[model samples]
Target: MMIVCAGLSAVVAGGAGAQHVAVSVQVSSDRQFVPLQSYVQGEVDGKLLFFCGLSDMGLHVFGQGAFPAKNFSRQIVMVDRATGAVTTGTTDHLPLATRQAMTVTAPTAVQYGSILYMYGGYGPDLENPGDYFTRALCTAIDLVQVKNALQASQPVPASAFTHTECVAGKVAGAGIVKLGDRFALICGADADGEYGSAPDPEYTNVVQIFDRNVSYVNPVETLDDGQGFFSPMHRRDVNVLPVRMPVDRAGFVVVCGAFESGIFLYENPLIWGEGDAVPYEDNEFIQHIGGYEGPIASLYSASHDRNHLLIFSGLSGYEYIDNEFVWNPAAPWTRQIVNLHVDGGVFARELVLGEMPWPLTNAKLVLENTLPKTTDGQVLVDQLPFGQPILLGRIYGGIAAEKQGSVSPTYASDAVLDVYVTVTPEGPVEVRPSAFSRVRGLHVSGGLSDLLQSDDLRLVTRPDVFRTSAVPPVQIQVVGTSPLQNPSEIKFTVESRASANNISQRVRLFNYDTQKWEQVDARTMPLSDTTIVVTISTDPARFIDDATGEMKALLQYNALAFTIAPIWQAGQDLTMWTIVP
Candidate 1:
């Protein structure tokens, strides 16, 4: 879901003595390589390796040689999580040609245990700067050895690269996810080279699958036929993100990404195994992230019941000026970090965590320590015997540009992003029960002390600005067990010193067919000099209209929202709703 609710922020009081479950970010000075993206990255034992990409943080001048040559006998950048140390290493034993192909940009890499397996990308032809060669090689780095070598201040161990295989046509830019023995290559493609216009490389409209057992067993340094795949997926790109659900194991979502070399935002997320892909108009979330022509990275939360995807620096918001798209070739990438929080079942919410100091995108989010998981891959919360924060790991470089439309020789990066996660005990769930009905998961603004203060109880509108076309209500959701949705009346008690007429209120039910809100009438009566009871009833003649199926769609909802804009402070609103059985 793009987003069910726009936002939800509260000044709630909790016994934990903290304000809100928040996200924090910090950055270290680069002092090494410049900003870089679309390169191969992997993490092991708290050490991160920034392998192969446009070596310089500027326009990739054609004849600048592969990263292996540039890094030859030189130390490769490595970030240590435990000590927050940024260092470099050298794989001096690898052959010159081998190193050159390995440093190719736009390659695909995935980390499992101590092994970092990488695939195809565009590398040097050794002749023209613009003309390039599509690399047809796969290399595996033994991360444990590299980490140990970095510790000893030694060149990358001779045994660092335990295996290398050559597999043609398995190009770069594919969204890869390892599922058991099979790894899927979600909609990504490659070309012969960006050699002129007519002979430009074509994209593949297929989701390719490769068997790990078959892929890794090839003779070291020998080329293989490498025939293992499942085809015919809609062409996708760097935007595909992994999300595991009970129904779909090892599932992934392809958000806003380029297809057919064109910038278009799909409406709904494209699932890995969904028959055919169809997206809607998404202007808020993914559409805002430029053409997605740049790099993007994602990491999921390990806390149970918390599903959040952190997307860092992928060219934010395609500029639209006066109803026209303002396309700029030199637009710099974003420094903003967006957090997508999934709550209330399929309902999802969006929040902006914070921003990085500089433009950063297309990087790595490596897990430093082991995360508890069930046999089914669900987050293993009960498995934990104690309560403590998990120091999951850190984020590494992407492309960091100096300015918009920056010239070449300055377009990459060498920096570290520090991250930490804290979790608390689950609090008691609040349930609203009345003589007629019961509502579960009703999150109110107050704690025990605030709820006890009668003076703080009143009816007022929500403080935050809710989107104009939202249905049901922002915080009030109704899950009625009974099929009788057409309640004869809904009663709510409120306290107000002003005239009852001055307390303007409207009740809107979600219309299923029109996808809009329809307002209904409510009658009011005085409860006391400063209190009142408002009753809203359904038209029985409307139920008769429900028989025609036309009005049935509109009257078939179990819950409705009441937007009450009282003169009093809305943050103090005290609301208790009841349905006439």
Candidate 2:
């Protein structure tokens, strides 16, 4: 399948049938593989066979509920990027500890030259803590042997891998990136056990470079901790994508992740470089980009200097309320297929709405377009102006949540997507959201009716009309004084002219995950002239079970509003206001 997105001018000049750079996605009908096992994956010889991950085949999210020992999978899953084919086999033959080190939930992992190196992740305790009980264990997968065995159709032996047990430096969830030879692992903590609240001594915002030749990681510098505000220095669950400079040099762009040090936890994509202890420039490029944010995947187009980040669906952080920071660990997972133009080490985000699947967090994208014959083939970076539809890569095995909380039980996604990027002459494409129009009747309604009065729904208030007959409950859609990327509780209060018994109010909320409107239950105030307030929110408790990140976009796109009316009596009227506090 091919989807085209081109500039209007280019298309008009080229006439109909003109093509431009476009992207499309297709899920194979017959390829439903049970991917209960989740793992950090990398392309080996351009194939996805190098990995260390496990998913509980049962019905639970990673850190939630009891850890199921029986279904823990330690396997090398190879996904053919060209055809969207996934193949897996148990790597359980390796030492149990090595497998566990690689199987920890949301570990900082990367792959290089037939070796999958994983560091710092949350999991069961190991005796070899950096001498302490920790999940900061590190392990390496020797894909050279695994690949040979697979080519021969022979079972892999346990001796084919290497394990580096815990140390004070052994950390989980640290953000890491590789320049040439050195792997700079950044900000993470030493945890005692699984899903515990906090870490003992937070791993200082230090840069630990693990050179390929060195046996141990060497600490270089520590970053200044941010006090009164948020900083990326002391953060975990962060991801970095590769970028190329206009010159010969290239580096990684650190995407935003979850940070708990502040009163509120959220992500703001920041770019920094190893060349300088300072970042490219302190900037947060806001785009339509979506992701599970932390446990995410990225593909860089060296030719285009563009990084395609696959932000699968996952939880979001909190919004600052009156004085408190309200967080939603299970912010609905919305599908985000975004990219960034990297130049001079700076990032410019491009929020593109494309033909994509639901966001898959904790998922891995493997490039399969490289030469297939050689074991060490050249890496193929996606280039625009496909001239025709071309397969870009494949996404396999990640968790898709059905609930708001990451701790809640979630089933593994069973399908894999094949991304086809095409460049046509259609010109640069822009999509405008459809105009909203609707008005409510007597009972209850949602959609455009809840929005504020417009030219379509003109509000001509006749104060004199209340002198005789009855007044109707008013529904209003609100656009605020300022725009909000992450919003907290939005409140709607009605000052009723009648007795408290005559007050009634309702709201229509859009649930992106379910693609439905949820009704907010209304209630009356205690006073005679009641002031009834109902809050519309993204709080997991207030939203539908599986709603996702798209809700924020829907609300921001001039679609947030609610209704207020008199339910018990006919001769009553009310005044209303909306507040996002």
Candidate 3:
């Protein structure tokens, strides 16, 4: 008989002084209870169909003898949410390779309508005596038949699953997102050797696109910005969710993942839209919490043009202690639940809402409740009724750690948590007036001079007028106001006009922490007036000066022959700074 765990209540605050959204988790059992993690789960008619994953606590040990076949989750589990009835099925009818592929750990799985599409995972090869490898196979499971068989407590028919072999299926621990009719297999590894030994695993630093039938389309390699830096796409075991992009477009956001080099996790997020060739790495924002695979949910506020993403407790690189964000290089498991708000696909703000009841990791299944949602599965937050507790979704199955560290005793979590959100009534949105600040000093040709304090289009750095051998970047200093305390709260709008569309400018911000000038924005200026808004949302006070409260910026020019208009006021000039309340 299956045992159903009671509801565990956890109320997390939204934002600073925002209403408290009560979130809770209630464990439900449909049949005989079996603990599992890193499994593929899909919901059909209020029933959950769970496919291959790991049944052991924590992960496989790193040694010569790893990934024992006994630890593989071989049984198919089903849970009825309405009645709490649990059922199980077997994989004996599947072929050896298909069975091995179905039982492996951390395979990419995404449910599209009634079909559950599952891809490669790391496990033992049944064909070989003492070998384990990442399976190169994709399986399409019929959830309707699987649910029916499980509900009847009968064997699942072999026809319920269709297997295909392709090069795109050779990925494990990767994030999979459906872009319209195509599926993108994001960064992951294709490992064959034993854990922590011998040949290093190859990181697939490319997005493998697949059609609706899991056939290969093309691979989008990581962008080469000529910096020769390690691409952030070399990630695995991360969380990726379908997000509503600007103009209600479909996209996905790749959250933090592990092993940048020797177990250091990536702290930044990579965002990709539907039609983009590659995803954009948001270097300006550093995600401190929810850095690994866990329960994630998203809601879109069409009225406000913002997307709110709720990330539950998981592994993280930083933790808040004594009101200070402390960096943990070890990347330990955390109970921190973060709410990331993205406005117009440009700016992102992270708020630490609350924590989970305990430090849990690897619980990656979130079955959304029957709420009004868009076609891409984003909850329409604007249409929901206000001031009441709303059922968001249910989180099921992960590894529960005893402590928040790299080394800790763990167990397979049996908690089926019911996630709830209480939407509070918001006032009418206010459009804040753009605040402009004048440039005080200018540095050109290694000489410090005061720029003319005027609200006119003064030619400050014209290559054609000032016949110079090299175009020196004009450095400007602007004192920040008290309202501009953090980077996310401030927006820098630089307006400029060039003689030709080929003329480009690079904007760099001086980082006081690094003592180096970092390029923030670089774009080609058109013949008409152009405005570029740069927003930094990662660290609160990285670029600001502590003692003098001053910020420095540089404008580098590149063109055949062009002139840059100087700082203008009253929305008519080169530089303008605004703060969002």
lDDT of 1 by residue, 1-581 (tens): 11112111111212331111334556644323345556677777667676766554443333233233342123456766556667776544566655655656677766666788877776654445455666666677777887787778876755676435455335666666655555555555565654343253455555555666666523212111222122223343456655554444454555545442243433234444322232122234333332343433333334333344555555544433344334444333555555554331131644455555665555665554566643222233333322234544455666665643224224456566655444322331111211111111123233322221247453222323322233312222221111123435444333322222322333334344455655553323232333434555654223212222112111111112333443111222232333342
Task: State residue 13's C-alpha deviation in candidate 3, in Å.
Answer: 20
RMSD of each: 17.0, 19.9, 20.0
Q: What overall lDDT goes with each candidate model?
A: 0.44, 0.45, 0.65
lDDT per residue (tens digit) for residues 158-234 in model 2: 66666666453566556666656666666665555434233343544545656666653343444443431234555
**What range of 10 consecutive residues in model 1 has the weakest lDDT sum?**
549-558
In model 1, what is the error at residue 278, expressed in angstroms? 11
User: Which segments of model 3 are wrong by more than 4 Å?
Assistant: 1-33, 213-229, 426-581
Error of 1 at 126 (Å): 5.5
lDDT of 3: 0.65
Candidates arranged by lDDT, highest first: 3, 2, 1
* TM-score of candidate 1 versus the correct structure, residues matched by position: 0.55
lDDT of 3 by residue, 356-388 (tens): 766776676454556888765678876664444
Per-model TM-score on C-alpha atoms: 0.55, 0.57, 0.67
